[model samples]
Target: MDSAKAEGFAESLVDLINKGALAVMISIGHQTGLFDRMAELKKFTSQSLADYSGLNERYVREWLKAMAAGKIIEWSSEPAEFYFPSEHAAFLTRKHGSDNMALYTQYIQVLASVEQSILSCFYQGGGVPYSAYERFHEVMAEDSRQTILAPLLDQILPLIPDLTQKLATGIEVMDIGCGRGKSMIKLAENFPNSRFMGIDLCAEPLESAREEVRRKNLTNIQFKQADLTAFRPAGKFELITAFDAVHDQARPDLVLRTVYESLNDEGHFLMQDIDGSEHLEKNLEHPFSPLLYTISTMHCMSVSLAQGGLGLGTLWGVEMANRMLREAGFTQIRENRLPHDPMNCYFIVRK
Candidate 1:
């Protein structure tokens, strides 16, 4: 091996390990509200922060040391005070919504919990089921509410012209893989004239969705637990949406075909999915390829394989997605990118 190349790789590995540890600490900080408490205070001692957040002081101090070492927070040795800069807090605090990336760090621990099962899948050629990962839907619901629901009304739905007006006038709408039904509920509340249905394979999130609907007294929305691969709706929809969901399906191709069949003649299908390439070399320069591929292996691809279906994975790419949409009988397809969301591309298709 080239000595320089080996040394470079070794350094990279060290950095990776450090970042991994930092990720776990960041998750803890976010979950414990330490970050939020720190954001509120200009400067604080670890004990003070723990007291403010109602967490144990010892654990908070240890976590703060890691954050300081990770360069996530500023430290003063003389006073033993830590400062979480407003800039860093912008991306870590829950108040920041989709910009709060600390919410995503939780996935590192979640995925680690399934490493053994994933390793077994590597050896045995089958896949780990969704039931293997605990708190997945809970995490995904928070992610969706921030990323999808946060922008659905302004950025996402506007991708199709006059779509918001159509929704206002009462059009049939359905969301596939609508985890927790947050997006559908949001739309249903905004457009009382329109009816909404959210379908997912998991019953747990659907139950949560139903509870929210009841709590909100939403009359225009409903949730159903159904396998989308064999999905058949009683009535066609004027608008169908699948947000960051299609790739995880056991039969993405069949589901896309079903979406086509379930749409009215004048209906539109909006899909939000990862952006990359069918060709591996083409994705080499993509910034988030490493994280996206890791998530695909640990969750997206594996879940599909559990159902003995096509493991298209997360980086299914624009070329493959467009080709598949055309194959699904969509002749008019327009791909749009949102400035805020760099990880996914939005597809607007008409029957």
Candidate 2:
């Protein structure tokens, strides 16, 4: 091969490695305050980092090379120091802001484990740790509770006139796949009189959720480390909700049946999921649609399938959801948007 071509190939190989490696590397960099340090120091040099962070110079040198190559940090040619993307400071490093970097730790850390989950596990009846399911929602809560998700849910959530009436009377609700408890927390905050329960299998995250639950001192919020199909409610809840998790379960049919049984006579099952518009062909001109579609595959669909999860929708879409509710013994079904997905429908099934 030509020298130029060979050099380009080698450079591309290194770049490919950064896709997975960057998550961990950036996580460490972020935690060590490397990003912050670079911003403050306003230059790159192993000597500077060694002195600033009090680390060995060799380690700093190696790290900075990757950071520079990754374009997460840059070497100022004139200043001969390192710096970060100025705008990233607001969202990537800021923890308290609604736009937070916590997703780095939450989502990236599990890339391997989630990717390894096999579709056969669900079909052959292999068991998944309760923890994985728990983790799914905890992470899910972060996405849905984001400023965008919340605003969307706010627009969409209020559309359920029946559920709203029940919430006004201090009714109890359960979020079956309440990842990180974002929905539970949001519900708790919005309806102070209403009580909320979250069920998931992952213990590691429930610990985190439990802490958040207590930190909020939300007397009404409760969490359980149990499988959704087996985790029985104490009694009928005024509302039983499962967000985007029904598809990830081994038996969404069974879980839906259970939700039907656990709901009060007139209680609603408020389910939120990605719009089936994923099946809709991509808009070649707009980049985001195809991006979401692929994400729906590798990260969302692939991982869920690996972990005994059904594809994103078995009974998740409007027509299928209507069918599932009827089969599960619900007498009435209403589909509406919950402000989260404009095209996605939140189905309310009356017992």
Residues 1-351, model 2: lDDT tens digits: 599999999998887677668767776676576666766666557897779887788877888888787776777767677776666655555443455553545455544454445344445634344344324555555556663344534465665675665675699888887667776776787778889899876666678778887888888888898877566778888888777667656567778889988988867787765445423543344334543454454355554444566655322345566677789898887766543244345666687
* Per-residue lDDT value at 64 in model 2: 87
Q: Return the TM-score for candidate 2, rounded to 2 decimals.
A: 0.67
- Model 2, which residues run further than 4 Å from truth? 1-18, 30-33, 36-61, 95-108, 113-156, 162-169, 276-326, 329-351
Instruction: List residue ranges in candidate 1 displaced over 4 A.
Output: none
For lDDT, the strongest prediction is 1
For model 2, state the Cα shift of residue 286 in Å: 10
Instruction: Go through the candidates in order and give the clash count of each.
Output: 0, 19
- Show the colliding residue pairs in model 1: none
Residues 1-351, model 1: lDDT tens digits: 799999999999999999999999999988888888999986999888888888888988999999999999999989889998999999999878779999999988778878999999998987888878978999898889888989989888889999999999999999999989889999999999999999999888898999999999999998989999887999999999998899989998999999999999999999999988877799899998889899999999999999898988988889989989999999999989898898899999997
